[model samples]
Target: MVKIKISSLSFNYDSIQALKNVSVEFREGEMVGIIGPNGAGKTTLLKCIAKLLKPHKGVIYLNGRELWSISNKELAKILAHSLFEVPKGFNLTVLDFLLTSRYPYSKGLWETEEDLAVVEEALTMVNAKHLVERKMEELSDGELQRIIMAKLIAHQAKILLVDEPTVHLDLKYQLEVLSILRRISKTKNILTVMTMHDLRLASIFSDKLVLLHEGKIIAIGKPQDVLTEENIAKTYGVKVKILKHPKAGLIVIPLSTL
Candidate 1:
């Protein structure tokens, strides 16, 4: 079944259109990556799916129901978002922060043993069990990113929307984060959608790639099918070569300017 169906979607900020006629469907347990250069509608499309920004036209459905009809509480059950920044005054430890994800179903701002068990499982998923007691501020960029992801795991949302999850992470952490997401999609049957700038990385880990440019979807399909030289050149205004890497399998090299 389709976990998310975005049809004829269009969005605008005043007269400036951010997205135009974008349509796509995400199935359960699929890892779909959105990639494009800066100023492209990658983030806009993600925000639209997360229901953080409403589209001016078209519709978004979650499990065949209108997204708008789903209450916030209900939405929380099916969808969870991981933004780039940590909220201020969040002085909680890694464990404490991760447990907050279960708040939607818990009571009195406290987590029960079941909640703790869930949090522990999330930590183990990211191999973050050792850092559970560390302060959020004390961890490195990569460690903190994993902790946040662990929170989403604890939330247990079927659909996950992440925005530039590896923006501040190092190369190793970048791969680790994406690898974790891919594993989650397979093992947990969660539909994962993320906006990524690392084209090669996205192509390698994602089952499907959606390329957006100039407020529209330029291409969408398997990474091998969608990340073509022609499509890359047209969308980014730069010529690129698509090659099979010896190790990574898919590699994108920007050859020249258009």
Candidate 2:
């Protein structure tokens, strides 16, 4: 079934248009990745779906009902999201951070045993149970990434809207984080939609790809269909050679002078 449906969406930042007539639908259990160049409205698209930014003209439906009809608390239960870090001042532990996810269900009261159990499972799911008491600020980049992911799992939402899950991580952590997300989506049967700047990584891990250009969806399909030479060249303004990798199946190589 279609869990998200966006139709005729448009958004602007004052005079700057961000999204234009964009429409897409996400079915249940889909692991989708959004890819685009710097100003392709990729982040805006995610924000719109996450209800952070309201479009001037469009309809966003969640499970067939208009998205705006759902209250924030209810939406929090249905959709769990995480973006690149913003300003921070919290001193929550890894477990504390993860347990916060249960607030939508518990309303800031003392957590029940069920909440603690879910938090424990979430910690183990991300392989961070050992760091349950670790201070969030003391973690390495990769460790912090996993902690955030564990927190999301604690949320227990069926749909995850994540932005740049591998931001500011080294190559090893990048692969590690993406691999964990891939595994979680499969094992938990949740639909995940994340935005990534690395098209190669996105193509490798994503079950579906949404290619955006100039605030519109230029292509949307399987990685093989959306990551074509022609489409990449037009959307990214780069000369790319698309070939089947001996091991990676499909890979893109840029052949342009910087």
Candidate 3:
């Protein structure tokens, strides 16, 4: 099985430090959510793993090999990141956008039948085939979100790094998107690490949770273990009541600000 092992990872933006000696491990078929307040280095952590941002001091191993030693082209084959924001005024169709996900595998300037097949398969996997011909400017928020998720799946990477897969959507769409991501992690046996702002949703969907506070990991383990009342209080500065829902699993209700 594919695995990610990070040790002593540190990153900085000149004077400002983003991550501080953060170490964590993730495994295949597990959906891990990184939850913290703003400026907690959630996105920075993903960027470092994707090699979009270089870590100042750290060692990241992907499937037993050093990540920095891996070529960018080879890394693209194993890792895919989805920063799911609806692009405005982009004159592109869903099919056109999804096809771009095959750039790493494309040999020619044009797409092959295999590429088209993969695109179609990805759309189907995300239940977005009806949106294939729709323009990017014309999709509803939920539809556009689905298209973005399809684009990520089209990459066919083993590690899926999603930055806030559910954002600016209604309750229905949020659950829908999260459910799709959770299902894909198991079905594809890919390691999914997403940064989520919703603590309740993170607690319910994630097999493991990495709770970050001020660029450092305060807790990392199973959702039940990491999302304790004390952890929430200490990190978020909020007094919360964690409820065990009969249907929805863990429910973290913020009772008051500390």
Q: What is the C-alpha lDDT of each candidate?
A: 0.87, 0.86, 0.90
Inter-residue clash pairs, candidate 3: none
Give the Å shift of residue 43 in candidate 1.
Answer: 1.3
* Residue pairs with clashing backbones, model 1: none
lDDT of 1 at 76: 83
Native-to-model Cα distance after best TM-score fit, residue 128 in candidate 3, in Å: 1.7
Best model number under TM-score: 3
Report the lDDT tens digits of candidate 1 across residue range 108-218. 766789998988899998999999888787889899889878887889889899888888999999989888888887888999999988888888888899999988999
Candidate 1 Cα misplacement greater than 4 A, ranges = 87-90, 107-109
Worst 10 residues of 3 by lDDT: 83-92
**TM-score sort, best first:** 3, 1, 2
> Whose lDDT is greatest here?
3
Off by over 4 Å in 3: 84-90
lDDT of 3 at 87: 69
Clashing pairs in 2: none
Could you tell me every candidate's TM-score relative to the true structure? 0.94, 0.93, 0.95
